[model samples]
Each structure stands twice: as C-alpha cells, then as structure tokens.
Target chain A: MIVARTGNEAMAEAMRQVNPDVVAAYPITPATEIVQIFSSFVHDGLVDTKFVAVESEHSAMSACIGAAAAGARVMTGTASQGLALMHEMLFIAAALRLPIVLCVVNRSLSAPINIHCDHSDTLASRDSGWIQIYTENSQEAYDSVIQAVKISERALLPVMVTIDGFIISHGMERIDILDDREVREYLGEPPKRPNLLDIDKPITMGPLDLQDYFFEHKRSEIEGMNTSLPHIEAVAREYKERFGRYYPVIDTYRIDDAEVAVMAMGSAAGTAKVVVDRMREKGKKVGLIRMRVVRPFPKNYLKELIQGFAAVGIMDRSDTLSTLGGHLYVETRAVLYRASHQPPIKNYIYGLGGRDISLEEIEEIFEEVLEIGKSGKVTEPVVYKGVRE
Target chain B: MPSLKELIKKQDLLSGGHRACAGCGATIIVRQVLLAAQYPVVVGASTGCLEVVTTIFPYTAWKVPFIHSAFENVAATIAGVETGYRALKEKGKIKEEIRFIAFGGDGGTYDIGLQALSGAIERGHRMLYICYNNQAYMNTGIQRSSATPYCAHTTTSPAGKVIPGKPQFRKDLTEIVIAHDIPYAAQASLAYWNDLTKKVQKALEVDGPSFINVLSVCPLGWGVPSDMTVEIARLAVETCFWPLYEYENGKYIINRKPREKKPIEEFLKKQNRFRHIFRHPDRDKIIARIQKEIDRRWERLLKRAG
Candidate 1:
C-alpha cells in the first residue's frame, strides 16, 4: 500500500520501517523536521528505537559513531553548518566502515550564511569516503533512504542521502511510501551480529595505519566503494520487485535523440525535468539527465548515456576551489575524457545558497547548451545563470 | 590490597599489537580505563594521541565498540550514547547493563573541546569523561596547548633567550569541572595506576557526569627517555607539580599526598623541554613559582578533603 505523504513523513515512515536501533541527532534548520517526526514516533511508541538528543551537530555524528560502532543500525540527520561540524567524524565513520546512514538536507555553508537548498554542504564532504546520493523529489528522497541502508550495510560503507534544503526537505509533496510489511520484507532481517560487535569472534576495527600501510588501507576503502555499485543496483532491483518503485542510480528524462542534454541533481533536476517536457512538446531536442549517486561516481554509465549527445551542460550548486570550476563539471569532464566517445561539455554554476532555480532558468540553460554546441567552443569554466554581478 | 588476579580481568577491549609509540602514556591510560570499566561499555574518543594510535582504517586496536569523533565532541558524544542507552533500557529493548565513557587529550578536553564538555555536564548525562592531560598537542608534534605548564618548552612555545618557555600556567581544568557541581570529578596520574583505577571505579558508580583529569606524560613530546615515562609522571606528583585528588558532590578529597616534597629540579632535569629553565636562572624562578602554585593548590585540596 502507498500513502501520499510529505518528504519529512516519508523519511520518518521509512525509518520506522527499518527500526534503527539508535537515532542520534541535534536539531538544525531544514533537517530538524526529520528528527522531530522521528522523535514523535519514539514518544508515541510507534517505533522501538533509542532517540539521543545531542547538544550539537558535532555530538550528533559523534554519538552516531558510538552507536554504529556498538553494532546498532544508527541514523542521523543534519544540514549546512551542522554537516560541516561533523566533518571530522564523517571521515571516521567511513574509515571505521560502520555503515551509518545519514540524511543530509543540503544547505549552503556559512560565512555569509544562508539556510536553503544547495549542494555546498555535501559537496564539502565529497572526499570524506561516503557514498553520496542526491534525490530530486519526495518520492526519490524516501526511496533512496531505505535503499541507502541496504547498500551501506551490504557494502560495509557509510551512505549519505542528500535532499535539497527547504526545497525537498521542507516542501510538502505527494510521495508513495512502501507499507511497513513491504519495507521489512525488502530490507530483510537486520544483521544479527554486525562485524564490529561479534563478541565470540573479536575483530579489530579502525586501527592505526602507519605510513607503510596507509595507502593499502585507503586502497581497500576504494575497492570496497567500487564493489558497492553492483550491490546498490541489486538492492534497487529488489526494492522494485517488492514495492513496484523503480529507483535508478542515474535517471534520464527524454535524452534518447537529443543533441543537447542538461545534467543536474537534487530538486533542481525536478525543474529540469519539467523544462525538458515543455521543450520536447515544442519540438525541441533538449533533454535532462539527473545524477543520483554522486560518489563512487557512475562514470562509465554516465559516459555511455552521454555518448550520442553532441553537447552536455553540467549544472552545479557547489564550487571547487581554484579557477571557479564547479564539482560536477570537473567530474563530468573527467568521465567524458575517459569514455570511448566524448562530447562538448559546458559548465553552469547556478541556484547557489538556496536561490530559486525555476523551470524558466532550466530552459535558459538548455538554450545555452545548444548555443555552445553550435559554436563548438567554451569560455570560462563557470557561467553564472539567473544572477546579477 | 586486592590481588591483580582477584581483580576482574576484562577481555582486552583495546587489544594489543597496535602501533602506539613504545611508552605512549595516552595509550596506557586508555587501556587502563577500558579494563577498569565494566562490560558492555561504550567508548567515545576525541581526535588526539590515543585516537590516532588506535584507529586507522582496516586496523583498529580496539576490540570493543569504540568511536573516534572530532577533537571537541568526546564529552557530548558520550552524553548522547548515555542518553541512547537510557532510552533503550526504558523501552525494554536493551536489558544488559552498560556504561558510557569518553577519552580525550589535554588539548581536546581543556581547550577545543571545553564548550561541548561544559554542555554535556550541564545536561546531566550519566557518563565519565577522562581527560588524558599530556600538557601539549603531542599528536600534532608537540605544539603548546592550554594545559601546558609554565616554563615547559613546546614547539610552539619555545624557551628562547628572550621569551622563556610557556609563560602562562596550565589551566585549572579540575577546578572548572568541580565548579559545575556534577556528581563527581577528580585528578589522577598515570604514575599511580591503583589510585587512577580507584577513581575510575568511583566515577563509574556515580549517576551523573563524572570528570577525570589524568596527568599522562608524553615521553616523545616531553623530550624524556621512552623508558622513563612512568618515572617522570611519579616525580611530577612527588615534586608537588601534579597533585592527585578527587571532588565528589561539592566535597574535595586528595587521593595521593606527597609526604616529603622533592625539589622541582628533579622533575625538570629529566625532560629536555625544561632544559632551558636550568640554563637560565631567571627562568628557574618562573618554574619555581609554578611549583609553588601547585603546592598551594595541594594544600587547599588537603584542607577540603579534611
């Protein structure tokens, strides 16, 4: 059975189904509702889970590490500065291989601080060894979270499920939630003895790797992450079989015969989808390809998907240090260079710090991609869209 | 005295074969704390010497459930873990007895991690926070920390002809923890394992936040011979430099009192970091004044413990 619910409710419902042993969290803007709803479930006795009220975001992730270490399926939520505060532990969680699932309501990092939708927060932690996934709508956000648990546990890697702050996180939208029985059946029995907690068979975790062993240890983490791709797809397939909801690592919208395809992720992809629909109706060949899994990046699949296209426009909400290059554009270019067939790619930096990204802006992005394709030339690394200055 | 065999031999929570430097004081304290703790204990460690030596990807020294968080969140993390355990116990999901403990270095507990520690104490979480006070940021190559004693030479606070070592006295973290009026707080040293063990047991028995400031000597950072780690720690207390005491329910108790206080030079001469103090007579007076401060604090503690 499917119920129409908001993003927060969908997340809470998914968590209730999983029945995480521990939920450690401190309230932050946009991400607070996820914890608030879960707290209510704890209060109402709907879910049997430990709800830890931490003092700050740092403590939230810290407590999560302890709980996850103790072989508990631990879940936590944060955004923006909160995510930044947990930066140190993010690396620890990955290194420890605790399979902690974090819900990140993507928000702008501070300085000239703004608490709204953007990829800056998660992007800052791009190299923190977490499998990062971005969702475009309430449904994807809900489904990705459950799928994340399966992928993380199976692969023994932590997963971060990101939804745009105040956009998908706060926006009320109709979402299909899998029934409790279906969710349980799909996820399967929680591991009776997590690798860290098997008392009979004592296994040491998170040991000090000296300079001689550090590279090999890091390489193993990479190998573990690389192994997660197939596991993610397999879990997604099982999810579809159990609940009739298809979740693709990369979702393409009307990109079959298109010359110019605009690529984006998170809620901005929703606007691009609408724009693509309108463009197709008007007899234009413009399309959209939304990236879901951003880490252990689906490079090979992305290369195949973009092979036939003449021009690809990469839209990003986060900046990479130096040269005004955005993170997505850098990864996309790298993937295209390694692919058998390549395409002309133009980078667009937009919708930063929760600035409104409208369908009209996406249409404009589509037009710009076409212009770049015709010219067969690109100027600066980053082209500002819907901005003054 | 309880025979070592009679004491409950805990399954090595922090197993051996880890890559801590030979005679690393922080690792010793961590191992001792884990052994002193009851079974089903959750450990939250801050990013410092103990954490660095124990946790590297795919090769943790810890056999128990161990967590290494940020430099400043150990107290908060343990508090949260305690909260989670309490919640689980109340819900009947968890039936086993468990305790929560946090380990941190001087830099983590006394400096960067102070706010989080204060918050955790104020919230009244049932946990013990042990600050392994090594006096400097030993993990990051001996930079001066707020807990560094006066006239102690660190990489950042070098004793040149003009400057004369770390001029400021070490921050009184135990007194600050005591001011919070938590259930229990104490100061211990790696030199006195029995006293430290007793303090840990007492703190575990307390219901609310318990703070333990352990004076852990860093041989590498302190410029002392590796084998002399325990000896230097002993001289620190004997010279009335690092007094051992406990504060319980607003009452003070001096755990280890030195009957005949030794000269401060005996402790200073063993460490090369304090070599400059002996070379310069004016700096010697500064070290002497610091030792006097320690003596004064010990006298006050004795009065309170009465």
Candidate 2:
C-alpha cells in the first residue's frame, strides 16, 4: 500500500516489518528520527526487539556487533558524526563478517560541524567493507532497508543504507510498503552460521588476524565482495518477483542512445534525472546513470554502461582531498581506463555540506558533458559547482 | 556452592595450549571464573592480554562461545549479546539457560573501556563483567594505564631522573562500577581464590548487571619473578593496597579484613617495579607517602563497610 512518509518514517516502517531481534543506536540529527521512530514502535509492542539506546555511535555499533555476533538479526542508525564515531568499530564489524544493517541518514562530516546532507559521511566508508547503498527518495529508502537486511544476511557482510539528510530524510514522499507478513516471510529466520551464540557448538568470533593471516582474511573479503554481484542481482530479482518493484545496482535513465551522460548517486540523482529528461525533450543527447549499490561497486556493469557514452560528467557530493577526483569519480575513471571506450570524463564536486544542487546546475553539467563529447577532450578535469572557489 | 571436589572435577572451559605467559594472573582468573559458572556460558573479551593471547588464526583457547571485538567495548559487546539473549529467550528461541560474561585487562577496563562498561551496567544488562586488573597495559609492553599504581615503574611511567613512576593514584574502578549502582559490584584477587571464585559465582547468577574487579598481577609489567605472581597479589591484599569487598544494592560488605594489616613495603619490595622508589634520595619519605595513600584508602573502605 502507498503511504506518505518521510525517508526516516519509511525506513522505520521497513525496520518494523524486518523486525530484527536487536537495534542498538544513538540519536544523531537527520538519522535520529529513524531510531526514535523505531523506539516508539518498540514502546507500542509492535515488534519484539531489544532496543539498546547506547551512549555513543561507538557503543551503538559495538552493541550491534555483539548482538549480531550472538546470532540475532541486528540493526542500528547514525549520521555523519555518529558514523564517524563508529569508524573504528565499522571495520571490526565487517572484518568479523557480522550482518548488521546500519541505516545512515547521510550528512556532512565535521570540521566546522555542519549537520547537512553530503556524501562525505558514507562515502568516507567506501573501504570499510560494508555493502553501501544510497536511495534517491523515501520510496527507495524504505525498499533499500529491507533489501539491505536480506543482502547483508545472505552475503554475511554488514550493509549501510544511506538516505540524504534533510533532502530525502526530512522530506515526504509516497512510499509503497509491503505487508508485514510478506516482509517477515521474505527475511524468514536468519541464516545460521558456524560462528554464533550457540552453546553446543562454540567458536571464536573476531580473532586477532595479524601478519600471517590478516591478508588471507582480507583476500576472503575480496572473494566475498566479488561473489556479491550475483547475490545482489539475485536478491533484486527475487524482490521484484515478490514485491513487483525493480532495483538495479546502477540505475540508468534514457542512456540507451545518449552520447553525453551525467553519473551521480543519492538524492541528487533525482534532480539529475529531471535534467536528463528536460534535455531529452529539447532533443539533447544527454542521459543519467545513478548508482544504488556503491560498495562491491558494480565495476564490470558500470564500465559496460558508461563505455557506450562518448563523454560523461561525474557529480561527486564529497571531496576526496586529492589531486585525483572525488572517491566515486576516481573509482569510475580507474574502471573506465580498462574499458574499450575512453570517455573524456569531467568531475563536478557539488552539494557539499548540504548545498542544494539546482536543476539549472545539473543542466549546466549536461551542457558541459555535451561540450566534452564534441571537443573529445576534458580541458577542465574538476569543477567545484555552486561553491565560491 | 560447588564442592572443592566438584570444582576441580569441572571440565576446564579455557583449554590448554594457549600463548599466555607463565604465572599470568589474568589467565588464572579466566579459568577460575569459568569454573565458578554454573551453566553454559558465552564469553566476550576486549583486545588485550586475554583476547590476543587466547585466540590466533586456527587455534582458540576457549571452549565457550567467545567473542573478541576491539579494545574498548567488551562490556558493550557482552551487553549486546545479553540483550540479544533476552530478546531471543523472550521469543522462545533460546531454549537453554545460557550465561554471558565479559573479560578485559586494566588497559581495556580502567582506561579505554570505562565508558562502555559504564553504559552497559547503566542499561542493566544481564552479564558479568570481569576486569583482570593487571594495573597497566601489559599486552602493549607495560605502558601506564589508569590502573597503574603510584610509584610503580611501568614502561610509560618509568621512575626517571626527576620523578617517581605514575605520580597519580590508581583509579578505583570497582568503586566506579559501584557508582553505576548495578545489581552487584565487587573486588577480589588471585590471592584469595575462595573469595574471588565465590564472587564470580555470585556475579554469574545475578539477574542483571554485575561487575567484579580482580587485582591480577603482571610479572613482566610489575618487574616481579614469574613464580612470585600469586605471592605479590597476596601482599597487595595483606598490605591493604587492594581491598576485598562487595557493594550490592547500596550495601557495602567487606569480604576479608585482615586482623593485622602488613606494611605497604611488604608489597612494594616483592617487585622491582617499586625498586627505584626505594633508591630515591628521600627513600623513607617516599615509602611513607605510598603507605599513607594505601592506609587512607583502606580507612575509607572500613568507613564504607561499616
């Protein structure tokens, strides 16, 4: 059924349906409502969850790691600073291979301490070994939470489902939700593992993997990440068959015959989509490719998709602080270097610290893409859009 | 209470063939704590002596479900597992009666992990938190931790040209845990095995949060002979440097009060950690000061116990 809810509300509803055994979280703005809403559901006795209101994001994630290690379906929520606080434990959670679903209301990291939307929060954790997914709106936020649970459990990897702060987080949209029974049946009893809270068969979880074995475990993660593509597609296929909704790893719009395209992730992708359609109506050969699953980053598929285009502009919401472009742009360029087609890619760093990326700015980005297509060379490699340089 | 025969006959949960140094007080605490536990247990340890030494790649010392996560969150981790147990038990998922316990060294417990332990106890989770108080960061090469006693020469708190080692008084972590007003909190040592084992039994059976701080000795860190570990811990107790007591539900009870408290020098002289203090220009004055601190703290314990 369709219901009007904020991204936080939709995510909370999805969490309710998923009805994990444990939720350990701390309140951080933008992301606070997700846990706050979940707390209310717990208070009402709607879900039999042991809600742990931890002191900090470190404790929140630690509790999740513990609960998840104890053979319970665990979940938590955080934002920029909260995720930052959870940084150390995030690596531990992934290395331990616990399927803890972390709902991140994506916000900018702190220096001057701004609590606004940016990819800096989750983007900073690209190497954290979590299966990261970004949603464009409340609908995708709701679906992504449920999908993340199944995907994390099936892959034996933690997942971070991100919704842009205030943009989609506080904003309302019509979300299509599945029945509680349907969602419960979809995530039936969590798949059992050899390492769990079983008394009969005891095992050690998260041992010190130093010099001799650390690399082998990391190699196993590489193997797990490589194996995730088929699992992601399989989950999505099952989700579509069961719920009548499709979620592509890297979603594309009007890119079939386009010579110029703009690639982005998160809520900004929606605005970029609008620009793509608007330019399409004006008979401009421009399109959009938005990434949903940013981690276990769809390398082969993204290369194949973008290789067809002559020129591409990558919209990065977070700065990498390097001479090389932003994190996503760098990864994209690295992958495309191996592809048959070498498109001249322009990197646009925009919407940092929650600055709105207007449609006009997106149109300008498409125009630049078209120019790069005709020029066959990227003169300006990096553009800090909408910011005073 | 289990008979001595039964306790001895109980299968050792922490197996042999681990890498802990010989005469390690912390490892003894683990073995005794596991023995005291009445039911099957799941354990979690912080990244310190117990964790690193217990598990490496293909081998693990634990026969129980042991989880080791980061340095500062053993309490939080065990609380989570306990919370999970409660949820699953409520849902009729966990059929057997299982207990939860957490282990950490002084570095993990008194310094880095204090906040997490505080949070876990404050939440009233059903788990026993055991701090194997080695008095310093033993695993990291004898660095100073909050639990490092005054005038003790650790690696970071070396007694150098101008000063004594660890000028500050050791933090009373047991009292800190008691401040959280958890269901049960206590202090014991390997010196008093009966007292420690009984406290462990009591803590394991508590329905809510329980904490036990054991002043375990570190031969390497304390610069004592490995064979003298238990004797030094005993001297620490006899000298009243480490009191044996329990605080449960707002009531303070001294478990063992020595009739004649030994001089603090009896404990100090057992280890080379305090050797430099004895060689100071004002050696007598320094010893008097250390004794005074120990005596004052002992008097406070008496006042609380009464």
Choose the strongest candidate by TM-score.
2
Tell me how each candidate scores on DockQ against the true complex: 0.37, 0.82
Tell me model 2's lDDT, rounded to 2 decimals: 0.89
- How high is each candidate's TM-score? 0.88, 0.99
Compared with the true structure, what per-residue lDDT tens digits does model 1 show for residues A98-168? 78898888889886778877798999999999999998888888888999899888988899998887777
Q: Considering every candidate listed, which one attains the maximal DockQ?
A: 2
For B43-147, candidate 2 gives per-residue lDDT tens digits of 999999888889987889999999988999998988888888888888888898988999989889998898898888888898899999999898988999999
Candidate 1: regions farther than 4 A off: A1-6, A28-31, A192-200, A371-381, B4-102, B119-127, B219-235, B257-272, B281-288
Q: Model 2: which docking level applies? A: high
- In model 1, the Cα lDDT at residue A370 comes to 86
lDDT of each: 0.81, 0.89
